[model samples]
Target: MGLGSYLIYIALLMIVPLWAQSKVKNTYKKYAKKATSSFMTGAQVARQILDDNGLYHVKIEETRGMLSDHYDPRKKVVRLSRDNYHGHSMAASAIAAHEVGHAIQDEQAYAFLRFRHSLFPIASLGDKMSIFLIIAGFILGASGLIMAGIVFMGFAVLFQLVTLPVEFDASNRAMAQLVSSGVIRNNEERDTKKVLNAAALTYVAAAMVAVAELIRFVLMFVASDD
Candidate 1:
């Protein structure tokens, strides 16, 4: 397909997830406040989970953007968004704990997470190289350039596949950690699950779409060669 058509397709693929994300974020904001009676700030809950899980080495830091919470495996840090960092709501607590889950995974050397980390460097390289390869390949219409583009896209897809289990396991950890730590009561587990599941859906959807796009690109190049 032409670049114009590709752009349109990408735009369309992006819109549904964006809309879904917005709706889920709103839903979490509405109900997450009512999750548990802990009344602990996000940072405090993060501390509790770290201490409880014996992950004293993992640091909690504030990051820019709303809902940008994540665990950076390279740095062994849990970066929480400003809102999630300091907010005194169930939403904040749950998110903080979720990041802590990654720390625990790192400590335990969880198989999937370790696999994801192993792919990081190549994935980073692939992320940067993919666009350049694709743009250059289109300009030259060279088979070698097209193949390079395909390889780069394949690396990215591999990263996404590895990331799937890491993220889902972290969400699972978050819920279990809360109960084990007494940060959240058993009765309120469902609320925590809802918010985390909603967040997880975004990642799962993105990975699926990435795979689809990569397959499309490969097929296009192959057909052109034929």
Candidate 2:
């Protein structure tokens, strides 16, 4: 019964995240093919947004790898993937704008963003250590080790929950900037929103997965106690 329950739980957790990832990729590809009417390349859009926001010191650079765009708050650089940096599609523009949104958050010192940044190192270590601790605890019948594992995993879960708002807020900022800057009209903004929303769902799926994992482990610890 335990084994069967575990299998079911694993299956349930996997489904939503896999589907969400596929949705994000498909939505992005669909919009990537449709060029924006504004004729503004993503790099141009990012630069304009930064300049308008008085973030002239932030740099935009093209990086290799699909869907690898991100804002490096430490370096104050907005990194865009190859296609997003040069392509004029709604997808490209929206993705670039979203990263710039992070830069905006940095400039404003958004609380959640700052918290997420501070948690990065601890979360990274916790993620790697949790599996080993859980496995060891289960094998050795050590409740204390198991509890430690749960606490470590809890940090990761907290990071994920915190990430939800940061991501959603970034997307919101992206949409507003896209509209207000004339980078995209209302109809085009709809397409951009679709892309951003699809991307946001991936983060939601991730948080769900993290929460499920934490719950699963806590249940395991309880069962072991019994």
Candidate 3:
């Protein structure tokens, strides 16, 4: 019965996400070799966008690792991976601009970003220990502990859901800025879209996995009660 009920969730949690991850990687690699017409490096594009938006206080810095780019709201810093920071490829420009979009979101007080930010500590703890708690609870046959695990995992699921819009909006902002600012030409817009869209699918897959996991737990809890 468990296998029958969870078949779809299992498929979604496994196949789709792996595919999305591969697609993003492949897409980024395909465009990473194509330099932008303007020949502006990722760091330059990011700086221009930030300055244009009056985000002079937001600093752009380099970070190690592929696709490690992110905006640290607490530090007011936009950290880009080495390739994105220094490379003048289409992939680099789009990604660097995307991180700046988050900075813009912070400056404008975007509600979803702010809410997700506020949940960081709780969600961090939940992500770390929820699995252990769930396993221990199941082993001990304790419904109370199981429910406690469910609540903890619930925060993680909520965070993933909230993150979807934040990511999409940031990508949208990135594309618009890239085009309007003349960082990317009209012909280059499609490539940027492909990269951003491929990246967005990863977040979608993540949200689906979180929802599926939460549903599986709820269903199991119900079956146990029955």
Instruction: Give TM per candidate.
Output: 0.88, 0.96, 0.96
- Identify the runs in model 3 with alpha carbons over 4 angstroms from their true place: 2-4
Residue clash pairs of candidate 1: none
lDDT score of residue 118 within candidate 2: 89
Clashes of 2: 0
Model 2, 71-129: lDDT tens digits are: 99889999999999999999999999999999999999999999998888888888999
Clash number by candidate, in order: 0, 0, 0
Error of 3 at 26 (Å): 0.5
Worst 10 residues of 1 by lDDT: 27-36
User: Of 1 and 2, which scores higher on lDDT?
Assistant: 2
Most lDDT-accurate candidate: 3
Candidates' C-alpha lDDT? 0.82, 0.92, 0.93
The residue-by-residue lDDT of candidate 1 on 1-226, one tens digit each, is: 7799788667757875796688678867876557367777788899889988788888889999988888887898899999778887677877898899889989999998888878888888888888688778878887788788779878888998888788888888888888887878877787777788777777777787778778787878878878
Clashing pairs in 3: none
Q: What ordering of candidates by lDDT runs from best to worst?
A: 3, 2, 1
